[model samples]
Target: MKKILLVCSAGMSTSMLVKKMQETAVKEGKDYEIEALALSEAESKIDDVNVILLGPQVRFQKPQVEKVAGGRVPVDVIDMQQYGMMDGESVLKHAESLME
Candidate 1:
């Protein structure tokens, strides 16, 4: 299964998105592992993740995340509008693209 790592400020709000994405993935019959963690926990989780997604609230940390994630993982910030509106399908598509 592909591994997706999500990072946010407190790791609370993004947990909701994580659930949505997981539901979307399941509905689409995609086999993957998705998890959400606080930005502070990213370093420890990076090694196990195939992709890193950032919540808008933590967009500023993209560079840092990229640095620590090295070149092995794809890292990008979730669209603020999409996230605020909780558009899971779009986010799931974004995550899927990273796998390619």
Candidate 2:
């Protein structure tokens, strides 16, 4: 199974995205673990994840998250338009590409 981590300012809104990602993963029969957390908690969550996705509001923190990720995982910022529109398929595709 693959692990994907999402980081945001407070983690609340991003949890919704986590749900969508989960649903997409289930529909595709993909084996994966996805979780969302506040930026403050990101350091502890980085170790085992394969990818790190940042919420638009937290885009400024990408460098920090990447530093902690230390090349072990690919880190990216989720598309704001997709995120605001709640486009699960697009987000899922983005996540899948990271694994590839």
> What is each predicted model's overall lDDT from 0 to 1?
0.91, 0.90
- TM-scores of all predicted structures: 0.96, 0.96
* Residue 33 CA displacement from its true place in model 1, Å: 1.0
For model 1, how does the per-residue alpha-carbon lDDT over 1-100 read when each residue is reduced to its tens digit? 8999989988899889989999999999999888989999889989898999999988999999999988889999999998998888899899889979
lDDT of 2 by residue, 8-99 (tens): 99999999999998999899998989899999998997888989999999999998888888898999999999999877779889988998
Backbone clashes, each candidate: 0, 0
Query: What TM-score does model 1 achieve against the real structure?
Result: 0.96
Which regions of candidate 2 fall more than 4 Å away from where they truly are? none
Which residue pairs collide in model 2, if any? Answer: none
Looking at model 1, residue 11 earns an lDDT score of 89
Cα RMSD (Å) between model 1 and the true structure? 0.7
Best by lDDT: 1
